[model samples]
Target: MKKYFRSGEIFIWFTGMGLGLSLIMITGLLFLIVVNGKDYFWASELVQITRTDGSKQLGEIVKEEPIPNLNLPDSLWNKGLMRMQMKIGNRDLYGFDFQWIDEREIKNTDLPKFASTIERIEFGNFYGFVKEILVDGDVKVKGEEEIAKKIGSYLDITSSIRNEIKDIEKSKIGKINYNIESLRLEIKKIEFRDKNSVKNKNEIARLESEIAKENRKYEMLKMKVDSLNLLASRYAVYCEDANGRGKTIPMINIVRVYQPNNMSFLEKLGFTLTKIREFIFDDPRESNTEGGVFPAIFGTVMMVLLMSIFTVPFGVLAALYLREYAKQGPLVRTVRIAVNNLAGVPSIVFGVFGLGFFIYFIGGTIDQLFFPERLPSPTWGTGGILWASLTLALLTMPVVIVATEEALTQIPRGMREAALALGATKWQVVRRVILPAATPGILTGLILAMARAAGEVAPLMITGVVKLAPSLPFDSYFPFFHLDRKFMHLGFHIYDVGFQSPNIEAAMPMVYTTTLLLILIVVLLNITAMIIRANLRKKYKSATF
Candidate 1:
């Protein structure tokens, strides 16, 4: 034992155990997320259940758990009473999507061959039996197999109309709105210049005329959208619940209709893949409890990239100055200590600071100078992508500085002397020799910073992140990258959908899916950076530097 202790075998065993435990914990967490979240896309068999009172319920059985005992009698303590959670969708009728049923209340349960699930645009999902398909207010199709097969074609028609409506409302009309706002702001600018001057008054009148034209254009687009909606509504799906309660859902409103109990494994797999694709690429709906998170994904990736652009050059310069040029003394040492200590500060404090310093102070000043017309209502004087990126850049600056300093230190003392002997200036030596060799280590710091920034929620919560953004920061508009626009982040999305949402049970799947996506994004970004660093490391390792 003494020999093993001296040889460090005991510590080695301890190290190995710690590493193994860490791997297990990480693997378990990922497994839990996958298990809970993956099933959100996979269709389950619909069970038509009969209660002891003879009332009927139709839904997919979501989960089963033993009832928790709370101040129960001794006889009930070990009774093993179980409850099952059912996603009995018909939100408009029932006012809720899920129900917890006591197992004792279940009189009978069977898979209904005709039972179906309908994904919709409003009131969430509808689970029931299809009674008929309507086109032009007439029953065009009836019967299970016929409705199931023919409904898709009608849905295709309605879906195309819905897409056209969306394009008109969000794109063409949106552009007209943007132009009108700009013209209004231009009038404001002219009034600020000289409210009573002839030139200014004429300019304001011209802008007002332009606004009227834009409004006329908007009305035309709105009319077009309304017509498309009216056309789509002509096609409908009339469905009945287990108890024969009927509801008429227009085909335009219904996203999909499928009988999960009858679906083959291949069909389910294809459905799952298609649903997953939509989740990745669709705009969120139903108060962000359903639909896709493409906006959130775009915001997160864009924010991280902006943060990288902000942090790298400044951090590298500061590190180069400190490690190469600065005199080593008490002041430098104190600065180093401060930088190290900054990393330990609570992230929320940084959020508060960002709100004050970035949004109120700097942004307010910018708005005053550049966008005086949009005052009080604030164009740049608000929480936005630019301010959020800068705040995170400040937060992660210390890590980059430290990493860069370490990298600079690792270059041999003799190298600098040799460069000086060869008539190389300090800047020349740094730009040519030191920087090239230290590239990988500098990337190491950026990798760490990127990972931390990608997962950060607190600072972003107050800085620029929102539950939903009307438009992405990047668009076809002039000055395409709208840095002043607010954004949605995957980290913030998870928190919002998981803890802040009204329907926790319904949103749980969305939360888990967002979490998984966030993890994957961070991993992919880091992997890309690592690949670059590896190639750089290989090139430098082979060099004579």
Candidate 2:
């Protein structure tokens, strides 16, 4: 045993075991997330459940489990009965999306082939049977066959109308409003510069004329939208719930209606894929409980890229100064130690500092100097993508600096001396030899920094991340990338959906899906960085040696 201990074989075994355990845990976690998230998109058969009390319940059986601390009479508890959780998603009628049903109470159940699941604009999903399709306030289709045939046409019309409305509101009307706001700001600027000058007055007059023209155009668009809405409102679908309660839902409000029980495996698979696509591409709605997270994905990528842009150069420069230029002394050692310690600081502290220094001080100064006309409203003097990126850049700078310094140190002193002896200046040696050799290490630091920044939610929440951003940072506006705009983030989106949602059960699937997406994104980024690093290492290895 003493010989084995001295040989360090036990320590090696322990280290290997620990690493293996870590890999297993990580793989298990990823498997769990995939299993839970992927099924959320698949269409499950609707079941009509009949209880002992003669009450009817309908929904997809989402989950079942043995009751924890089973509360039952002694005789009943002995049976070890399990409980079933049903997704009775008629939120508008039931006021909840889920329900817990005791197994004993469920006397009978059957998969209802005619049962339909309606995806709505608000109040979550509605599970019911199609009773009638009313066009122009008359029951045109009553039977299931007739309703199914005309339902597709009605849905197509509604979809077209919805697209038109979206275009008018988001594109045409939005542009007009943006132009009007710009004109207002310009007039304000003119008034601030010269309150009563002829040039100021003429500029203001011209802006007002432009605003009036835009407003007229906006009104015409609004009128057309109202006409489309009226046409859409005329078509309605009446549905009857499992409890025999009837509700009339407008065609415009119903996103989709599907008979899940009747669907073939291929049909279900296609529907699942379609839903997954929508989740990836669509904008989030229903307070982020429903729809896609495209904005969050966009914001996260944009912020990380911006942070990299800010952090890389400064970190590299600082490391170069410390490693190559600074004299070896207690002060330099202390500075290095401080930089190392900075990595341990709480991320939220950096957020507070960013809020105070970047937003309040620097941004406020910029606003006062350049955008005085927009005073009290605060353009830059608020949480925004720019500040958030800068904040994260500051937070991750130490990592880069340390990695770069280590890389610089690894480059042999003989190489530096050789370069100097060959009539190369210090700058030339560093730019040509040292930096090229250190590219792989620099990228390693960048990968680490990006992984950290992408997953960080606490720092982002106070900096510039919001539950929902009205518009993307990039747009058709001049100076297209709006660095001053607030943005969404996947990390914050997970936190919000997991902890802050009104419907925990409804949001749980979304939380898992978003988590999986974030993991995939981080992995993709790291893989890309790793590829670059590997290429750099291969290219420079011979030169370094």
Candidate 3:
């Protein structure tokens, strides 16, 4: 045993075991997320459950578990009592989407073929059986089969009209609103300069005339939308719940209707795929308990890219000065210690600093100087994408500096001396030889920085991240990349859906899905950086040697 210890094989084996255990734990976590989140998309069989009390409930059975003994009598403690959780998702009627029922109370259960799950625009989902389809208060389809077919047709028309309404509201009306705000700001600036000028008065009158014309146009558009909404509401689907309660849901409000109990394997698979696509591509709805997270994904990617762009050059330059140019002394060592210590500081501390320094000091100054017209109401004088990126850049700067310094140190002194001996200047040697050799190391630091930045939620929340952004930072507008805009983030989305959502049970699936996507994004970024570093290492290996 002493010989084995002295041979260092024990330590090697111990380290290997630790690494293997870590891999196993990571794999298990990923599997757990997949099990919980992936199944959310698959259409489960809806069961009509009849209880001993003669009450009926309809929903998909979500989970079953052994009953806990807490607050129970001794006689019931070890009786092996079980309970099943059901997703009875008629939130508007039931006031809740889930319910727990004891196994003993569930006297009868059946997979009802006619039961339908309707995905809606509000109040989560509706689980019921279609009774009839009504057009203009006239029964157009009465039987289940006929109602389903007619409902599908009406839904298609409603969807198209909804799309048109959304386009008009977000595009044409949005542009008009923006122009009116700009004109108002222009008038404010003119008033600030000289309130009595005839020229300014005429300009204000012209702006007022344009605003009135725009208001007329907006009213016309609003009327058109209201008419379409009324037309869409003319087609209604009457559905009856398990308890025999009837509700009339407008066809326009329903997103999709499916009979999970009757769906075949192929149909279920297709439904699951469609759901997954929507989760990835659609904007979140119902307070982020449903729909997709495309906006969050876009914001996360944009912020990380901006952070990388800002961090790399500054970190590389600081590292170069420390490693190559700075005199090795007590001051330099102290600075190195400070840099190392910054990495250990709580991330929230950085968030506070960002809020104060970036948003208040720098952003306020910019707003005061450049956007004087929009004063009091902040333009760049508040939390925004630019400040968030800069804040994260500052937070991750230490890691990049350390990695770059190490890379610079790895290049032999002999190489610099040889370059100098060959009549090359110090700058020439650095730009041509040292930099080329250290590209991989610089990228290593960048990969680490990006991975950290991508997952960070604390700093982003205070800096610029929002629950929902009205528009993306990049659009067809002039100066397309609006760095001053507050944006959504996947990390923040997970935080919000997991902890801040009104319905935790419904949000759990979204939390896992967003977590998975975030992990994939970070992995993808690191993989791309690693590939570049590998190629660069190969290119410079011979030259360095």
| Highest lDDT model number | 2
| TM-scores of all predicted structures | 0.97, 0.98, 0.97
Candidate 1 TM-score over all chains jointly? 0.97
lDDT of 1 by residue, 492-519 (tens): 9999999998888888988898899999
Tens digits of lDDT, candidate 3, 309-340: 99999999999999889999999999999999
Q: How far does residue 367 in candidate 1 sit from its true spot (Å)? A: 1.5
lDDT of each: 0.91, 0.92, 0.91
The clash count of every prediction, one per candidate, is 0, 0, 0
lDDT of 2 by residue, 1-545 (tens): 99999999999999999999999999999999987776569888899999999999999887898875558776666676889989999888989999999998999999987899999889988998999999888998899877766798889999999989998899889898899999899989988899698877888899889999998998899899999999999999999899899999998998888898888999999999899898989999889989999999999999999999999999999999998899999999999999999999999999999999999999999999999999999999999999999999999999999999888878988889999999999999999999999999999899999999999988899999999999999999999999999999999999999999999888888999999999999999999999999999999898653
